[model samples]
Target: MKIAVDAMGGDYAPEEVVLGAIEAVKSYSLDVVLVGDTNKIKEVLNRYGAKDNSHLSIVHASQVIDMGEHPAQAIRKKKDASIVVATQLVKDGACDAVVAPGSTGAAVTAALLGLGRIKGIERPCIATPIPSKKGITVLLDSGANANSKPKHLVEGAIMGSHYAKYILGVDKPTVGLLNIGEEASKGNELAQATYPLLEKLKTISFYGNVEGRDIPKGTVDVVVCDGFVGNVILKFGEGMAMFIIRLVKDTIKSSGFIAKLGALAVYPALRTLKKRLDFTEYGGAPLLGVDGSFIICHGSSKAKAIKNAIRVAGELAQQDVVGHIRKSIEEEEVEQYDSEN
Candidate 1:
């Protein structure tokens, strides 16, 4: 498979991006097209002794969408932006998938405008894999549409279910509506309206409403929520994880030498836990409902994160996630939005 990477999108652009692509090329049996300034990409490649490698190539994109710019407006104005060009490569079938470590808004806009949505999909959702006690739980509408309808949440469940089946390797993935209470009568109007719709779907394994604590507890394989709530939960989890880590360190320092020795004794286990908590290990989140494969990595991604993102991009392409989602939508006869506009 061939992957198009937005080499200029991340905090450590071109340099770290190129380094990660090179690592991916070496590790995986895939070709990579680095989309960015021709000279900068080539320099990074040459610096890392990855120059002139047949498995890697470059597509010169002159523009970049900065963090401060509006996503849709920048995409319309900057025709040669790295993220736009990379996404276009997927649309044009020049590459199997596109990986962008840029602003989430930019990535989503580029994908929507460049690739368009699959037939029967309204607003495309970001299906992010969150590590849980049992395993990985797929969280959809992670930040795509701030406000969504019951039908939209149902679509997310279908997409998230298929994702869990194919990518996460679950035999029968159970879905849960993210709400304040486990009962169908709880939550705001959106949750109450969405409950019956999800429970009625035979295509997916719906597990009724699940509270916020159930997310980390791994009560269900997939959690469905509108982008607004999902985004808040995602950010909160990230902050809480860091806070716990810092608290642990502070306590260790404040404790006596015996505590330090105990920490040293369990250093191997601590490193293992750290690896599990690292965001890079999960690669990037897949922007589902798009006609083509699109992976969005964190803006602060480095070599390891970028490398893993590329790996995920390739896997999604190879598995034909878009095709699966389209087929599921067709079979289910889900409602379609005015995609042309």
Candidate 2:
């Protein structure tokens, strides 16, 4: 499978991004098309002794969508931007998927405009995986649509379920709507109206509502909400993880010799904990409900994050996630129509 890499989309573009593509090519043995300024990309490749490799190729893109620029406007005007060209590669079937560690909005907008939404999908949402007690939990609408309707939540649930099941390897993954309380009637009008629709979905195991505290507790496999709330939860969780880790380290350092010894004893465990909390461990978030597979990495992503994002894109494409989502939505629609009639 051929994957297109956005060589000029992240904070460390064309350096870390190129190295990550090289690592992915060597590890996965897949063709990688690096889309960016060809000369700069080549320089990075040569610096890392990766130039003249058969598995790697470069496609020139003249412009770049700066992080500060407006996503929609940049996508429209900068047709040859790295992110736009990478997405177009997928739309034209020149690549199996597009992986970019760029501006999240630009990636999402480019995908929507270049590839379009999947059949029967109202809106595309970002499905991001968070580290949880049981291993990992999939959170959807993570900053994709700041404003969403009841139907949008229902779609997120369906798409998130498939992702949790196929990608996260959860059997019959239980989905929960992120809310103020566990009760069905506790949230806003959107959550209240979405509860029944989710309950009706036979494809997923709907577990009612999940509070913010339940996220780290691994209360469910998939958490569904509008992008506004989901994004807040995601950022808060990441910040909390960092805070706890730093707190532990500071406490150990400032304490007496006994505390230092204690910390030494738990150093291995702490290392494991760090890995669990690292955002790079989960790689990138997948833009679900879109026509083509797109993995949107963090803006500050390094080589490891980019490599894992490419791995994720490859896995989703192999699993035909978009196809499964379309089928699931179609089945639900049919069931709803028949029952109403």
Candidate 3:
């Protein structure tokens, strides 16, 4: 499969993105259409001795959307921005998928405007994979629509379940609605209203209500919530992981020689743990409910994260994730949910 990558849309810009695309082409045996300023992209391509690689090509997009800019405004004004152009390639069918390792807002906006939403989907959501004790838990609406209604959360649950099945290889993924209590009567109006709708669905395995702790424990395969709550959980978890890693390092350095020697004994295990906690290992989050495949990586992602994100884009394209989600929406179960409208 071929993928479009935003070469000028990350914190490291063309350098990290270009290198990652080059590595992804070699590693995944996929064609890459690098969208950005041609000269800037080529400089990195040539510097890495991949100037004539057959699997790689360039598409010029003169503009870029900065992280601080308004997503919808910048997308409309900067029509030729790198992220927009890359997403356009997917929309136009020149590329099978789009990978954006840049501003999440810009990436989401570009997908919504360029790719449009799938049939029966009111809002497209981000389905992010988080590491857990049992395995990975899929969280939806991570940063898509901050203020979502019950219907939106229902749609996200359907999309998230299909994503876990097709991409994550879960046969019948169990889905949970995030709330204050496990009882169906608990939570605000949204959760209370959504619980019954999710329970009535035959397409997915609904796991009642799940509290915050259930997420890290992997109590369910998928967690559906509003983007506001999901985004807060994501950021807080990331911050906590980094803080713990730093604390361990600082304590090790400040300890005595005996402690240092003891630490050497567990260095291998510690290294393994670090790799598991690394966001790069998870690749990136998939923006579901859109018409096409799009993967959004961390803005600070370097070479490894970008490469994996490209791989994820290819896998989603190969699996026809968008097709599966559309089919799920068209199923009789989803029609029942829509009957309320």
Candidate 4:
């Protein structure tokens, strides 16, 4: 499969992005098209002894969407921006998927505008995989749309379920609504309204309401929430993970000589724990409900993160995630229509 990479999207644009593309090409045996300034991308490739690889190629994009720029305006004004060009590749069927470690807004906007939305999808939501004690919990609307309706959350649940099933390999993944309380009567109007809709979905295994504490416990396989709440939870969880890691390291360093000797004994386990908590390990989140597969990585992503993102894009394409989502939504619509009549 051919995947397009936005080499100018993230903080370490061109350098780390190019390196990651090379790693993906070697590891996955897939062709990679790096979109960015041709001269700079080539220089970076040559620096890392990555030139002359038959699997790697470059597509020149004259402009770049800065992290701070307005997403919609940038996409409209900079028609030749790397992010837009990479997404366009997917739209034109030149590539199976597009992977970018750029501004979330820009990536989402470019994908929505370039590829359009799936037929039955109202708005595409970002489905991010969060590491939990039980396994990986998929969180939807993790900053895709700041405000969403009850129907939107229902769609998120449906889409998120398929994502958890296909990408995370969860069979019959249980879905839950992120809310203030576990009771059906809890939460705001939107949550209350969405609760019944989710409960009625035969396509997914609904687990009812789930509180914030349940997220780390992995009480449910999928958590559906509006972008406002989901984004806050995502950011807060990331911060807490970092803080805990730092606290453990500082405590270990300040301990006595005997304690230092004990540290070596547990170092391997600690390293494993760190890897499990690292966001880079999962690569990136997929913007579900879009016409084409688009994996959005962290803006600070390095080579490893970018490589993983490409792998995710490849998996989504091979698995035909978009197709499954369309079928699921259509089934739900049919059921609704029959019941109404």
Candidate 5:
């Protein structure tokens, strides 16, 4: 499948992005269309020995939308920008998915305005995969929408559940509502109203309420929350992951001789922990409820992260995630929102 990548949209720009796209094409045998300044992209590709890759093609765009620019306004003005052109590839059916390690706000705006939303999906939830005790948990509405109603929370749950089952390959994924308490009567008006809505969905394996502390425990396969709360939880999880890594590094350095030997003995365990804690391990978050699969990678992502983002794009294409979500949302009569102003 062909995936469109915004080559100019990142902190590292064409250099790192182009190299990552090359790696993806070489490793996955998937066709890639790099949207950016053609000469610059080719220059990077040649450096990586990927300039002659038959599966790769460069689509030239003159302008690049800056990270600070308003998403809607910039997309309109910068018609030939990497982000706009790359997203158009998906909208025009020239590519199966779009991947970018750019401004999260801009990516969200492009997906909403360019590709449109599914009929029954009010808001397109950002599904951020977090490592859990069991495996991984899908957190929905992770900074997509800061404010939402009870219906929106329930919609997020359904989307998160489907994502876990299809993408994460979890059988009968359990849904958890992130809340103040585990009790059913807990949470604000939104959570209280959503509690019953979640119960009505036969397709989802509802697991009742889950607190913030339960996230790392893998209390459930999917955690649902409004964008405002979900964003806070996502940032907190990321921050804690970094903190734990630093602590491990310090512990390894300060240990005595015997303790250093012990550290060596547990080196394998530490490696495993590091991999789990790495945000790039999950590749990127999929912008669910959009017409096509659009992945949002971390702004600070490096070559490895970009490569993995392509894999994520291809996998979503293979699974037809957008189609599945559309069908599920329609069948369940889920309430959707107008993403455009």
Candidate 6:
């Protein structure tokens, strides 16, 4: 299977994007198509001594959609932009999956308007795998569809549960609705409305309401929230992790001689803990409910993160996650309707 990457769309632009494409090509046996300005991408590849371009190829895209541009309008006007072209590749069957760290809005719009969604899906949700004390939790609507409805939250739960099981290999992944309290009647209108729908989904292991505190504890496998709330939680978790790491470093530096010895003693454990908390370790977020796998990595992602994103794109494609989710939702719908009668 082939994965197409937009190599001109991130904060690092051609440099990090090209380096990442090359790293993915060298590390995996899979074919990679780098979509961007041919000459600039080649220059970056040459910088990394990536001369053997057997597994790597480039598709020229002259224009670039700025991060702030209107997604739908820009996608239509700038037909040759890397993100648009990479998305078209998936539509045209040139690649099994697509990766873009460029404009999140543009990418989501391009996929929805271009490749379209799976049948029966109202909107595609952004699902990000977050590291937690229990291991990992799949958080949906992480940064897409900020304003959502009760049905949207229920859909996110279904998609997130499938993602946790299929990609993360968690069997019968327990689902939770992110709320202010674990109690059944704790949330506002949206959560209250979505609660019954989720509880009735026989295919999923619904665990009722889960608060923000339950996330890092990994008390549930899948956490469902509107994009607005999910995005806030994800960003807050990232910021807190960074702050704690910095604080730990400062504490160790200011510690007394004996305390410093204790810090050194647990240095290895601390390093492992720090790595587990790093958001980069999750690679990227997938745009679920799309016709094909589309992963969005961080705008500032370097070669390693890009490489991981490509791997994620490949794995999702190989597993046929979109097809599985579509089938699961359809089956659940039939079951629910039948039981109502």
Relative to the true structure, how large is the alpha-carbon lDDT of every model? 0.90, 0.89, 0.90, 0.91, 0.86, 0.85
Question: Highest lDDT, which number?
Answer: 4
Q: Considering TM-score, which of the candidate structures 3 and 5 is the better prediction for this target? A: 3
lDDT of 4 by residue, 204-252 (tens): 9999999998888999999999999999989998999989988887788
Poorest stretch of ten by lDDT in candidate 4: 332-341
At residue 4, candidate 6 shows an lDDT of 91
Residues 1-341, candidate 3: write the lDDT tens digits: 99999999879999999999999999987999999999999999999999999999999999999989998899999999999999999988999999998889899889999999998888899999998998899998898988888878888999999889988899999999999998999998888888988887778899999999999899999999999999999999888988997888779868989888878886787788888877667889999989999999988989889899999899999999899888878883454445233
How accurate locally is residue 224 in candidate 6, as Cα lDDT from 0 to 100? 94
lDDT (10s digit) by residue, model 5, range 1-341: 99999999889988888888888887996899999999999899988888888899999999887878887788877778888889999999999999978889888988888899988877788999988788788888899898887777777887788788888898789999888998889989888888888888877889999988778889999999889888888888889887887898688879778888888888788888888788777888999888898999888778888999999899998888887877778777775432231
State residue 116's C-alpha deviation in candidate 4, in Å: 0.5
| Model 4 lDDT on a 0 to 1 scale | 0.91
Error of 2 at 35 (Å): 0.4
Candidate 3 local lDDT, residue 150: 81
lDDT of 2 by residue, 1-341 (tens): 88999999889998999999999998996888999999999999999999988999999999999999999998999988999899899999999999988799999999999989987787799998988888888888999999888888888999999999888889899999999987888888888888888888888899999988777889999999999998998899889988999899899989999999999988788889988898767879999999999999998999989999888899888889999998998988822432211
Q: Which of candidates 1 and 5 is the stronger one according to TM-score?
A: 1
> Number of the top candidate by TM-score?
1
TM-scores for all predictions: 0.96, 0.96, 0.96, 0.96, 0.94, 0.93
Local accuracy of candidate 1 as per-residue lDDT tens digits, 1-341: 99999999979998999999999999999999999999999988999888989999999999999989999999999999999999989889999999999799999999999999999888899988887999888888899999888889988999999889888889999999999997889999989988887887778999999999888889999999999999988888887877887788778867999989887876677677777776557988999999999999999999989999999999999999889888888877776422221
Ten residues in sequence with the least summed lDDT for candidate 6: 332-341
lDDT of 6 by residue, 1-341 (tens): 79999989878888887787787877877888899999998888788887568888899999998988898899889988899899899999999999988778888988897789887677689998889888898888998887777777777888888888888999889999988887888888888878888888877899999988888889999999999998898899899988998799779879888878888887788898888887766778899988988998888788778888898899899988998888977977732332211
lDDT of 5 at 118: 81
- Using lDDT as the measure, name the better of candidate 1 and candidate 5: 1
TM-score of 4: 0.96
What stretches of model 1 exceed 4 Å from their correct place?
336-341
